[model samples]
Target: MTILDARESGLANGGPSFSLGNRLLRAVWIPVWRLGAGWTPRQLHPWRRFLLRAFGARMAPGSDVRASAKVWYPANLEMHEGAIIGPGVNVYSMGKITVGRKALVSQGVHLCAGTHDFDTPLFQLEAKPITIGAHAWIAAEAFLGPGARIGEGAVVGARAVAFGELEPWTVYSGNPARAIRQRRRFADDASNS
Candidate 1:
């Protein structure tokens, strides 16, 4: 294909990572997400979880996604039991995003699993999977980029930006995220396992 054709192809999908059906699904879901589900009390969490599942998210019953949080495509998201996505979080799941059991994604955190191929003039969309392991905690306002993996029991500090795999049982902080210290193991850890 010609260079012009390649460029046109990138934009042809209307900036969506998925198919027309997915776009239509989100179109329908947006209203419900912002109005109906978003306004519901925390006591009505089951109802909200139903909506996410109906749209294809593989989430366990105990997981909680706050009212203000936004998940781009439910089909590309998965969260295990006890996972919590706090208020104002944005999960740009252009690809797969998995949160393990008891993982906590704090308020205003951004899990962006999509980017662009800057090398190409067309700036084609590139999607990668993000995985947060069991008991990991992504602190408020952190940004986890495509292909980032927060290992089991890891803790990410506020406003940190992570673009790669973080070690297990570690504490990370700052932009680009550095390992600050080892995460302390809980007394109940053995009991849970």
Candidate 2:
């Protein structure tokens, strides 16, 4: 994933952060998504998926995104099979956000893939990618900052704020998420099934 510096990319000097084409796509997408899928019933996953795909989201079959969830740029999203973006989740995909197979992003979670470069004089926007590995679970209300990488089978507890890399098969919680415990290996836990 490329980290974009808005200033260096010629978007500084009071110019819009995104190109006209990007703005135009979003302009058409917002209302289309709202009218076509945002108010649909929860059971209409296929319908929602179709609209998302039409807008350039890479949604694998069986992936589900709730009606109340807000995806900033569908073109920057990629969800593998069985990945679920729950109700009220905010996918601020100013950059790429890849949700691996079977990952679950619970309700109210905020996946922010962009932030301002505070040290820069222009305070220019910086876009970095976020990745949630296969079988990971990001609990309700969690905030994942730009460049966060949640490993496979990891659990980010409710309301946690995560940044950078989280080890696989671990449980993390709190504001600056820390490993609270090592998660039991899913392969060894047949009881869940």
Candidate 3:
């Protein structure tokens, strides 16, 4: 993923992090989403998907996002077929956030694609894309930092904090998540598992 430096992008020096048009769209989207799908029942995935897609999210057929999930920028999100973003998940898509086919992000997970550059005096913002590979399972309340790549079929345990790349078919747990064990690889039936 390409990192976007706010200082180089002209967003530092007291400038706003986002362009005017982007802000305006978000302003309009906030209430639209709140009233349109936020109050819907959990079973109304299609309605929620429609609202997200209207804001430019690339949601494949069978991809599901819960009504309570908060997406910072729908335009920066992409969900492959059968991908699920569970209730109360926060998708802070300052950059792009891609959920691969059948990937499941559990409740209250934070997928943050933006952070501040602490070394810089100005504390400039930096954004990098996050990718969750196919069949990956992120357990409840986990935190994924900017540029995190959860490999295919990997499982991140509940409340874990993860950054960087995780190996495919691995089980990770704890703060600054470490691989706990190798998961059994499933062949073409990821949905069933």
Candidate 4:
């Protein structure tokens, strides 16, 4: 299979392939992020933006990357068309992170793409991509742990900590990200939703 398909399958299975990708990406990422680490906030954002595009992140026109945010591997992180990744947000993609089209990742959100394997003797690092579905909204200060999945049109409340699958079209809130409600029609539920 092609690399993209392989990555997708690995994301599904969290198997050995994903682990290898995480290690390989981390190997290249540390030095690259270090090189640009000294940049001024303004300069750093644009440079990182360029690197992300160069690495094949399919960003659309007018996507803004503020200098303050940190991205581990530009090539390994994919934000689709019209996605808004706000300032100060860190996408620590040690494996792979795919943010779908028109998704909103608010300011200061932390999405970790790798973790440790407790089953291993050394507690070695294990990489798994975090997938944010289309049109999902991850509020400010939310933390998405490794291998977390946010479904389509879901809303992750502010400061929520999500370490597992979040159902689609629902509103999830609090530290462990419990789903509090399902989303109804936007026009119908506007007042209380």
TM-score-best of 1 and 2: 2
Candidate 2 has which clashing residue pairs, if any? none
The global Cα lDDT (0 to 1) of model 3 is 0.89
Evaluated against the true structure, the overall lDDT of model 2 is: 0.89
- Lowest summed lDDT window (length 10), candidate 1: 1-10
TM-score of each: 0.88, 0.93, 0.93, 0.72
Show where candidate 4 strays beyond 4 Å.
Answer: 1-48, 185-193
Model 2 worst lDDT window (10 residues): 184-193
Please list the C-alpha lDDT of all candidates, in the order they appear: 0.84, 0.89, 0.89, 0.72
> Whole-model lDDT, candidate 4?
0.72
* Stretches of candidate 2 exceeding 4 Å from the true structure: 5-9, 188-193
lDDT of 1 by residue, 1-193 (tens): 1122333233655553345676788898888788878887777777878889989999897998888899998888899888988999999988789998889999999999888778866576777889998888999999999989888889999999998889988999999799999999765443220
| Candidate 3 structure quality by residue, lDDT tens digits, 18-87 | 7777788899888988889889997889988899999999999999999889999899999999999999
* C-alpha positional error of residue 90 in candidate 1 after TM-score superposition, expressed in Å: 0.6
Please write out the lDDT profile of model 4 over residues 125-178, one tens digit for every residue: 566778888778999999999889898778999999998799878999998999
After superposing candidate 1, which stretches have Cα over 4 Å from the reference? 1-17, 187-193
